[model samples]
Target: MAPTTDPATTDLDRVIGFTIPGRHARGRVARLGPVLHAILSAHAYPPVIERLLAESLTLTALLGTTLKNAEGQMTLQAQTEKGIVSLMVCDYKDGELRGYVKFDAERLARLGKNPSLHALFNKGYLAITFDQVTTKERYQGIVPLDGETIAQAAESYFLQSEQIPSVVRLGVRRDAQGMLIAGGIFLQHLPEGEVGRERLHVRLDHPEWQHVEAMGATMGADELADPALPLETLVWRLFNEEPEVRLLGGTSLARGCRCDATYIQQVLTKFPETERAEMADENGVISVDCAFCSTKFPIALADFVPDAL
Candidate 1:
């Protein structure tokens, strides 16, 4: 979809950015329909895990889309040494998004109905990473994943890691058609310039941030997840009274995974001959499956792996 400047218009699977000029705050609103269905349906994960992944995807979009023009990727990963869910990853590159979750089925089954994040990922830590492709700069922040949901974890990340006063809210639901729809809103009081940032640092607990966050906190999950509600309307409803609410429309997002047969084959060639042989079947074909997209790639061993190694 082409970029739109109108705040009243809406589209499926797009992230819209907005700013409250007087408050010195900026935010991104994400409303995803087809994108969420495409991602969750590919895996058909259990309901419990699906919800967790949904939250992860929404949170990823809320933060990832902020990487405006930079050709880079934002990745969120949660891991634990001992837990039902050992690992979960949600990545966004450009406007593409993908997610992966690994858990012990037996352990997950023990949870009755609703499993809290702490119960599912005991001692887990959430890691948010930003990798700028053009600059080759990578920055990561790790915070304990003790919150009830990924949204809460994100709030903790901004506070402890980014040191930015921010508020994040995410919602996911299965529509009547059984397609997963997710939405998220994020608000941060960004400093105008270096001088302004220095002043902001000196007084990190500014009242303007508190006010913006309070207004954002008033937004409920139902309103956010409503398929009929446009993102621009949500912003308007929340901050119309502010001096200025600047909204920019048109960053389309889709289900995305970085998987290439040739690239996979290249990586396999470096493996030892014995290891490569073990990966092959009777037909000498190595079947590699991508956890992100659930696509299986059968590469002919002779196509890339030499006899020597």
Candidate 2:
């Protein structure tokens, strides 16, 4: 059944974790509101692009909270030979999140109003990278962009690369006044053995897993994306039939970017002297703008001067 939203409900922007006790199954639900608006409003992205970015952001929140440490982060990246959407990167660090997309504006404009994922990113490859502070080595998996949406592509990555039975449902739409809203849910069947196995073991035949997946399919976009619907009710609406459904916890997300003048300074110092000189305008001032958040940082040529004292 679809969850209804009340007229007076506030924007819902949080991620919640849950588990099916004894069944060894886990899931996450993400609802976006003002955070999504903040991210998408930074640029003049078309409606389709806005929706795509929203899905990526929702997926990041769902996947990021799965980390064990407070400082861990995960990044999802996609690259394609087609000029439509050349590159896209979405990252979630700790509770912070940010992302950006690179595409051929002319080509994108030619595609018209609504373009399929395949049309937008033909022959693209999706890659997921994990950066945990405690681990000496970072982990990453690469897969082809085979599905109609980003959610489906992620599901393929889990089953094919991680050998886990996973499900992801994402919904994004604009309101009557053209406000972007997005939400998503994710589920994965845990192995009977202990967590964090050295090698992944496929477990698609579990009866409980099948049942959970079936119930999850019944969730509609109206229920998942509507800010009016409380997240607690959504979880119960989907899994109330289970014998031992339990809530792990929940965390709110915001549109966060790590870019700052200090970081941009470091980036500029790395450039060769000639390159630095070339970056300057007629007035010899260097300007840097963050593609993700569109925050501009203007630096004087003297700042790059070596030992001016």
Candidate 3:
């Protein structure tokens, strides 16, 4: 891919949506900057684990933005008991994103510089969940993490669960300034079906889908990682040959950690007195650390909680 020269700063740290009228395809592009670095730098993880988390966050952004609901939550989790990586989770809600990883460092060191999806997670599965706030409903889809990359697993989710023809590409690497930047592109053809089975299935052999998939494939890793390239320019570069391409609204993204003293205390109050007491330090203060952001909240029982209650 050629280097990008477009001066589109607005595209940074956000997800941009678009659709191709002639191609009957729609997609989302997410390029993260400070948000990506802030999340990864907070933890001292191996490069391979960092890359996996990067891709997870990128994919979450891509899939989360597709929700029409203004208050929906999207979560992606990949985990296995007998692998280098025990669990990796990333979630998105209304432009807020937070994620973390739990892995076996000793097992991870056993792998090479780079590890395949199966190598990282043996007999693992990728679960994509969406919590629709308006409808008060939740839906989840799980698929075997068989492919070499998370992108391939996502395509499987679309095929087996959503039944949409999809193409996904994700990349994570240091830029010219040595800052970690993550970017991804997702494309799916408009579904039109077969007249066969009792249940409808997307026609896997549509010319329109084939053409769109070909266009999506041409998107290079360099192009996705370049921060200078405006998202509009990125999409145009890929689908400009089509009759028409429309760019939708964009949403800014930031790392979100919903941890606070009051919230922690509320949770603590519900626990058994003995359990809460056990959690307290010698000074009778419960030090709560957020799993996502690693922020610490210390609450003193002396003043905050009554001895009788």
Candidate 4:
């Protein structure tokens, strides 16, 4: 029988990253594990598309963790000719994260399995938004689509927006039984000054940079998505060469959508009174489906009118 849960074993459901010794570089590996299993279980997606979304989720989580600035969420979105594309930004603050995506199924279908990010989103621009709940101001960075894959696009975003040089590798795959698995690794250039520059320069000057210094075995898809693999072991296996490597505690990741009745009611109120009445059902209830989570909510007609209005 396939194992259910084993805390001692390393599995495909964890995210791990590492900092290279003597180099101002860091790498990360993340596996969606059971959380992704739960999220996609109820939904039917083609293996290609499923993998795409899964990788996006994992990448989002990794980026969210790396980019620490405020206590609110970071949002990544794209408007494509194929359809509306989106990624939720969740942070460590209060464990709050949410996101959704809308794609043209027909268009995506024509593209076939394993569609390129550029092919799926031709002529689209990426927008990264940072929302601070406590403050009234929301900051946004917009950039043109440059990369061919999600990883490339994201790396471009970081370079252009934050001026941080990073290398990101993303993968999405499914098993023989149709189980979805998404995983990725990110190598980033840590901020450095004169001392740091000198260190990297000396290392590069050495012939060892060209030699294959096998520290550990190459990581495979099975290892990345396996829930049985302990995160620490995985990190050690991939990056034990780094003497100064530090293990930041792993954070739990999930598929969460920030859609509900209250927000829907506020949006409906903005429509004309006639349009609002037309949308009402026979029982005088207005039903709306959240674009993110597909949660349906019914609002009473009386709730539409504000007490002050």
Predicted structure 2: lDDT? 0.83
TM-score of each: 0.91, 0.91, 0.91, 0.77
Please write out the lDDT profile of model 2 over residues 78-126, one tens digit for every residue: 8998649998889988777888888888888888687888999999888
User: Candidate 2's error at 50, in angstroms?
Assistant: 0.6
- lDDT tens readout by residue for model 1, 10-94: 3468888988888889998887777777787777589999888887888898889877554889999999989999999999998
- What's the lDDT for all of these models? 0.83, 0.83, 0.83, 0.62
In model 2, which range of ten residues has the least summed lDDT? 1-10
After superposition, candidate 2 runs with Cα above 4 Å error: 1-8, 194-204, 305-309
lDDT per residue (tens digit) for residues 30-88 in model 4: 77655566655545655655666677777766766554444667667766654424332
Q: Distance from true position, residue 126, model 1, in Å?
A: 0.8
Residue ranges of candidate 4 with Cα displaced over 4 Å: 1-13, 16-21, 67-70, 82-98, 132-139, 175-177, 193-222, 266-275, 305-309
Q: What is the lDDT of residue 295 in candidate 3?
A: 85
Score candidate 4 by TM-score against the native: 0.77
lDDT of 2 at 300: 71
Residue 192 of model 3 has an lDDT of 40
Model 3: per-residue Cα lDDT over 7-74, one tens digit each: 35535688999988777789999998788877887788889988898888999999999888878999
> Runs in model 3 with CA error above 4 Å?
1-10, 192-204, 303-309
- Give residue 99's error in model 2 in angstroms: 1.3
In angstroms, the error of model 4 at 68 is 4.1
